[model samples]
Target: MTQTFIPAVFYRGGSSKGLFFHARHCPPDHAVLERMLLSALGSPDPYGRQLDGMGGGTSSLSKAVIIGPPTHPDADVDYTFAQVAVDRPVVDWGANCGNLSSAVGPFAVDEGLVCAADGEALVRIHQVNTKKIIHARFPVRNGKAVTTGNATVDGVAGTGAPIALDFLDPGGTVTSGLLPTGQVIETIEIDGRAFDMSLVDASNPVAFVAANDVGLAGSEHPDTIETDRAVMALLDRLRRAAAVRMGLGQTPDSVGLANPKIAVVSAPATFVTLDGRTVEGAAQDIAIRMLSMERAHRAVTLTGAMCLAVACRIEGSLPHRLCSGHADMQAIRVAHPSGIVEAGATVFQRGNGWHVESGRVYRTARRLMQGEVAIAPFEGEGDR
Candidate 1:
């Protein structure tokens, strides 16, 4: 039997990595693409380790991105991100990957999908899943995107050229407004205990709860958070309750931790980072521990950063309480498990409530391996 080959490029964007595919080369049918993606990533492995395919098992690595010529009049490219489940044969097209979104501009510039200038290129991307615009700006040395520089970000090691991503009108991408539940804070009863949380809609829908409320010191390592089964189960229940309040209408058992993520936030007080460096309370405005797919995120997602940026500005919110004296600052440095990430946001009160005009963050990306990824024939489907 002849194996099917698909042209794809693997890239490391921010802290996560994913396979980037050209829309022109991908199967036009959604069903076909769905199966192909699962095979390419070796999903439904049950062992949760994608040992036979391109995926690295974790949620951040089990991803695929589809890009093409601009679909919107104001954008230079159309980007659709896919989150492939490592343990199940499911491809959730429910939200965009903020880390992977940083790579789209460089991919577009290299693939000839869009032309770029010699110095810097501004790529206007139409994010398909969320119906949002991500303005990606990066330096271009020579005729291609620059991959080397001194710019550094948390989670990712070393430094590289910076990619500035501005999410315009980032609010309400997945919900009705900035406060998806129509309130800055809401208390839910879980197992006879009341937990107050804020559901904010930025680049994605996220439920913010204080670290103390979720049983954490806010400075614990990912290993500690991931290994504690009881803690994880508690977070799942909290996330599911949030999903209901936010109108996500999906249970954690069925949905498997995404779309509307849960983040445990803490106030800015001296704490040690994952790398053993003490982060002074004065250096950061707030501390965050974001959960991606039910596990602790090494660093905050670009979307999560955007969500936190907005949350910090909303009065009475968990993040806002911790981020005191930063209401007038243009940017908020979010201290996560990895390090500090500074995200900028423009927010103000509108007719009804507080609104986020945009959210911005800096990231870097590099094309790793580019070639044809051969995949086995799908079950019941003939070889391509």
Candidate 2:
């Protein structure tokens, strides 16, 4: 059988990388799309290595984003994101990819779907999966997207022009409101282990638990944590419990569930980062160890960081209790495995509950390559 050639742009969006495609160039059929994307990413491999395709094996690198003309009146582009599993036939479409959302603006401008005005350009994107609007502001010089600048993100090496992403009215992204459980804190008994956690919904739905509550110091490196099977399983159970409590599912055993990310957080303390540098408490508001696809993330996610930033300001939240009282709430610096990520949310009092007007994160994106991706005829397609 002849392989299908689909045009896509391979991009490095902050810490995650994916294939960016225009909707006009992709197959409209869902069956064909599943085969195409899985083949493009080399999914369902028992070996856990996606060596036969574009995926880099890890969840962060096994992603794809589809962009096109806006379907919403307030947006300039329609963005659909997909998280393809490396070792399984699962394509999780339950949430948006905040990191890849950073690159949609540049792809829109370059694809002629939207024209950016000279100087700084503001691109309003409609995230189809979550039905949220994201406003991206990036520098445009000589009618092209600027890729280099002085902005230095913790995970990405070198500096680049800052692409400011503002997720407006970010509450209820996957759930109903900022506090999905309608409670500041909830306790669950999982397999005889009692765990306390807070569920917050800003840019995304996340379960925040104190590291100490989970028998973790919040200072362990990602490599150490990832390799420990007991620790990973323990965190997964807590995360699943949070998901059921947040109404994502009936129980932890629910099938095909993947939203409501889980993060183990703690007060800022001295910790050796992934790059061998020490992150002192004085330099960060809080420390975090978030999981993506059941594996520890090397850096904090854009959406997860946004939720943490908002949770830090709430009156009675886990992150708030852990965050060192800071004079600048707009720059909530969070220490992660990579280094420190500054995530901010425009949050304030609206009676007894918190209201987040918008959340801001600075990320940089680069168009790695733009060409046709060939998907061979495979017997099975992946599901997420």
Candidate 3:
């Protein structure tokens, strides 16, 4: 066969979109799977625009997911996330996509992977990449996951049914512990300059730095930040340095492109959002700007926001210091370029170290399309 077609479903989960497949339809060979995903997403495109495939030419849009029976006894289904690089042939499985996670339960219910009745339904998901459990709860009617509701997610237009996600025991997702270096706050040297940062790993690992230290206001638009070559280079250097310290990699170059995200943060400040709305500093507790797949994220990643919320609860962390005035609040208001998102985290210090009980957030997802995705056949591959 000149081409192969794989059954897939396209979904918009929170602020991100990805193609979903059942484990039964995927190739068992790791190498073949990588090639299929890369081709299906139109990766390795020098133009940075994935016009040839379903990808939307950004980190959040170039993604894939696999769902099957849960390997962990405590979960209902297994959800694995794959981050497909837009300009490279690499697919990073080092971390989980919190945005896409919201859709897993709905997909599972709609696809018959799980049984549900009317009213609210809960699907315990085993996040394969991070080895974590995410409890996804949403509304169900007529034996189908509800898609129409009044909930509004900042980065997404229109309203949809709200999905509440609770990440249990979210600490130490990709590193040694919540505070990877065994300190709430630490300093990393980049270009001979010492900069204070907090390396926190909750739903995902993130390196939080002061925006002022990096010569930024933390409210800059994604395009504006991406255009600044000097600032981009500096952030990458700091992120790599922190990754090494977090034990994600032995060398800076060994770190994967998706894990150990770097974020610039500051106290809430007035800023214009991508949708032309002005948000006041007083309306939010803290402001953030995060990077993913080497590009500025239009909005903060959901896991990154959850991690930031956990960091804010840590007394001495940079996020905590920035938003200390409202540190006592149960929910944290995170201001990003696209607007504001609220995340809640429960944490407390034990004799040995700090422990995170859970991180919570609300998002909406929609199934945009369901069909087979076509890809060119690889060499030596036969028709099934």
Better of 2 and 3 by lDDT: 3
Per-residue C-alpha lDDT of model 2 across residues 1-384, encoded as one tens digit per residue: 567788889999989999988898888998678767898988877888898889998888999998988899999999999999888888888888889889999888877887877799999999998899999999987677899899988888898889999999998887888888778889888778777788988877898888887778998877788898888888888888888888888868882435788899999898887778877789988999988887788898888988899898887788888899543655899899999988888888788776889888989999999889878776553431
Q: For model 3, how does the per-residue alpha-carbon lDDT over 164-273 read when each residue is reduced to its tens digit?
A: 99999999987888898999888898768999999999999999999999999888999999999999999999999899999999999998899899999999889999
lDDT of candidate 1 over 101-148, digit per residue (tens): 999999998888778878879999999999999999999866689999
| C-alpha RMSD in Å of predicted model 1 compared with the true structure | 1.6
Best by lDDT: 3
Error of 2 at 74 (Å): 0.6
Pairs in steric clash, model 2: 89-383, 90-383, 90-384, 91-383, 91-384, 92-384, 149-161
lDDT rank, highest first? Answer: 3, 1, 2
Off by over 4 Å in 2: 255-257, 326-328, 380-384
Hey, what RMSD does candidate 2 come out at? 2.6
Candidate 2 lDDT at 18 equals: 98
**Local distance difference test, per candidate?**
0.87, 0.86, 0.94
Q: What is the lDDT of residue 243 in candidate 3?
A: 96
